[model samples]
Target: MSTDVLIVGAGPTGLALGIDLARRGVDALVVERAGELFPGSRGKGIQPRTMEVFDDLGVLDAIHAAGGGYPVGMIWQDGQRVGEHRMFDPVEPTEDSPYDAPWMVPQWRTQRILFDRLEELDGKVAFGLEAVGLEQDEDGVTVRLATGGSVRARYVVAADGGRSAVRRSLGIGMTGETVDPNPTLVADARITGLDRDNWHIFPPRGEGDGFLAVCPLAGTEDFQVTAQFPEGSSVDLSLEGVRKVVAARSHLAPEDVTEVRWASDFRPRAALADRFRDGRVFLAGDAAHIHSPAGGQGLNTSVQDAYNLGWKLGAVLRDGVDEALLETYEEERRPIAADMLGLSTSVHRGEVRRGEATRQLGLGYRESSLTAETRQAPATLRAGDRAPDGTLGGVRLFDAFRGPHWTLLAVGAEAPELPGSVRVIRGPAQESYGKGLFLVRPDGYVGWAGDTADGLPRYLARAGL
Candidate 1:
C-alpha cells in the first residue's frame, strides 16, 4: 500500500501523530507489532504542558474524564499510617497556566483514549504488522513488513519503543547511563485492606530490604504496586511471587493480594539517540529518548514529540511550504529531550523536586532557528515562548487556537494583512501577553514577536503562513 506517512508502533506517539495527520487529511497508516494496545499502567503521570496539547487535539475532555488528580502519599510503618507525603509540590491553577499539576491515568487508558480519538478522525492502524526493514530513495521510503507485504510512503516515523527495530536498522547509536542499579517490579493488582485514597508507601523494614509503594490507579479499581530490589536480584512476576512480596513488605496478607493483571521489571536508565533522523526515517518517543519514570517526563515527552512533528509534517505535505521546515523538528526537539533526560535522572536520584520543572510548562525554544524576535525590547512574553491562554476581545485564546491553524494575536498592535489560512485575534493589551504582535505556530509556540506589524509579513512568509 502507498501512503504519505508510515508510522511504526501504535503507542501514544504513533497514535497521536496519526490523529494529527488524519485531522489534516494526510494519508498515514500506523503499524503495530502487538496484537492489541499496550495493557499497562507504566507511564501514569500526565504533566500540565501535555494537558494543553491534549486540549488542542480534542481529547482533553476525555482525558480529564478518564483520570483524576494525584492523591497524597501516605507513609506506612508496622501497618499503621505514619505521616503524609506529597508526591508533587502544590501549585494552583492560574489564568495563563490552567493545569498546574499532574494527572494520574494508567498508560493503557491513555493509549486507549488516543486510539479512540484517532479512529474518530478516521485514522487507520494496522495491528500485527511489523516493519522488519526499510529502504528509502529520493522519492520516498519503502518498508518491508514481516508479513512479506510492503508499504510505500513519502516519509516514515519510528515510534517503536526503546529497542526500536527501525532505529536499529538505521544504525543509530544511543549513549546513556544506568540511573539505578536496583531493579524495580511494577504491577497492577487487586488488593484488599488498602483504602483508595492516598498512595501507601512502605519503607524498608530491615537491612537488604527495599521500598514498596501501592498507589490507587485513578479511574479504575486496580492499584499499581511498585517494589525495589537489590542489585543483580531476579524479579518474579507471577501471582504467588507478587503475593509474597506484598505480604512481606506491607500489612496485607497473601489472600489480600487477589490478582496480578499486568507486571514487569526494569532497571532505571536514561538514554538519547545519536540523532533523531537518518534520511527519510525519523525516531520519536522511546525510540528517540529513554527516561527514568521518576519525574513522569517519559510519556509526556513522547506525546509532545508527536505533537511537535505532526503540524510540521502536515505543513510540508499539504501546504506549499518548503520541505526545509521538517529539518527544524530534530533541531527543536532533541535539545528539549536532552534537557528532560537530565531532569528525569535528577528526579530519580532525589536531586530535584517535582515542581515547576516537572510540569514542563517552562520548556520553550528561544534559541531555535525558526524563532524571530523583531522587537528591540520585548516584555516577559517573547518569541520562542509558549502562547499563554487568556481572553482577547471576548474570545478565549485557547478557543481560538483549538484547531489546526496558525493564530496571530494582535494585542494592542495592528495585525498585518495576511493569508486567509491564519486565524487572527485582536484586542487591547492583556495582563499575561502584554502588548505585541505575536505569531503563534500550529504547535502553540510564538514564532515571532514584534511591537507592530512592521516585520510580521516577512515572518509569516518565512513561516509559510
Candidate 2:
C-alpha cells in the first residue's frame, strides 16, 4: 500500500502519529512488529500535557470512560497518602496560571484508545508487519513490509520500537547513558499485607537491597511490583522472583501473594536519537528516544512526539508548506523527550535518596522561534511543561481539547474573531501573560503561542498555521 506517510510500530508513538495525521485527513499507514496491541500494562500514568493530546485525538473521553479518570491519587513511600502535589501540577496553561496535574491511566488502556481513534478515522495499523528493508530517494521513500509486499511513501516515520530499522538504515546513533543499573523486579501480584488504594513506594525497608513499588492494575486488585533483581538472574519474572523483590524492599512475603498476572526485568536508561530526521524519513517515539519508564513517560512522550510531528506532516502532504518545516519535529520534540529522560532519571535517582523534580511548571518550550516574541522565560515555556485545562460549568475542558480544526484558547481578556479557522475561547488569561494567548495546535502542542500582541493570523503565518 502506498501512503503519504508510512509509520512503523503501533505502540503509543506510532498510533499517535497515525491518529494525528488521520485527524488532519492525511493518508498514513502504521505498521507494527507485534501481532497485536500491547495487552498488559507498560507505562501506567499520564501527565497533563499528554492529557491534552488525548483530548485532541477526541479519545480522552473514551480513555477516561475506559480507564482514564484520576479516580485515585498518587501514594508515597512511607505508606502515607501521597497528595496531588507530588504529581507535577502546573497551573492551568492559561496565561495567568502556573500548573496542572499529570493524569493516571495504564499504558495498555491508552494504546487501546489510540487504536480505536485510528479506526474511527478510517486508518488501520497493520500488526505483525516488520520492516526488513526500505529504499528512499530525493523525492520519496519506499518501505518494505514484512507482510510480503511494500509501501511507497512521500515520507516515512520510524515509530518502530527500540532498535529501529529505519533509524539504523539512516545511521542515526542514540546519544544518552544507561542509568545506574537500578536493577528492579516488576510483576503483577496480589498481596494481603499491602493496600491497592494508591501507588505504594517502599524504599529498602529497614534492611533490604532496593526500593519496592506497588502500582494499581486496572480491572483487578493485583498491583504491579518493582524491586531489586537478584544477583544472578534470568529474564524470567516468575512469582518467586517477584516475591523476592517485594520481600527485599518491602516487608511483604511473596508466598502470601496469589494471582500472579505478568512480570518482567526492567532497567531504566536515557537515550536520544542523534537525529530525528534523515532526509525524507524521520523518527518518533522509541524509535527516536528511549528512557526510563519511571514517570510513566514512555507512552506519553512517544505520543506527544507524533502529536508535534502530525500537523507538520499533514501540511507537507497537503502541499501547503516547505519540507524544511518538517525539521521542527526534531528541533522541538527531541529536547522534550530528552527532558522526559532526565526527569524520569531524576525521579528514579530520588528513589534511593527519597526525593526529586526539575518541575512540571519547570517544563515548557521557550526555545523555538514560535515563542521567541513572547519573551517568556524558559521556566514557563520549558520543553517539559504541563499543559492546562479549564473548568467549564460542571465539566472541565482541558487545554488539550482537540478540534477537527485549529483552536486558539484566547487566554487574554478580550478575544478577537479570526473567522472559523481558529476556535477562540476567552476568559482569564494565562498567568504567564507574556506567553500570550496560547495558539494550541490540533495535536495539542503550541504552534505559535505568545502574548496578545502577536495576534492570531500573524501567529498562524509564523507557523504556517
Q: Which candidate is the best by TM-score?
A: 1
Q: How close is candidate 2 to the true structure, as a TM-score?
A: 0.80
lDDT at residue 150 of model 2 (Cα atoms):
86
TM-score per candidate, in order?
A: 0.99, 0.80
Shift of residue 59 alpha carbon in model 1, Å: 0.5
Q: What is each predicted model's overall lDDT from 0 to 1?
A: 0.94, 0.67
lDDT of 1 by residue, 194-226 (tens): 999999999999999999999999999999999
Point out where model 1 deviates above 4 Å: none
Clashes of each: 0, 29
Output the number of the lDDT-best candidate: 1
> Residue 89 CA error for candidate 2 (Å)?
8.8
**Residue 413 in candidate 2, Cα distance off native in Å:** 8.2
lDDT (tens digit, per residue) of candidate 2 on 165-234: 8888778899888775656566767787765565666655454355566767755566776666444445
Per-residue lDDT value at 296 in model 2? 65
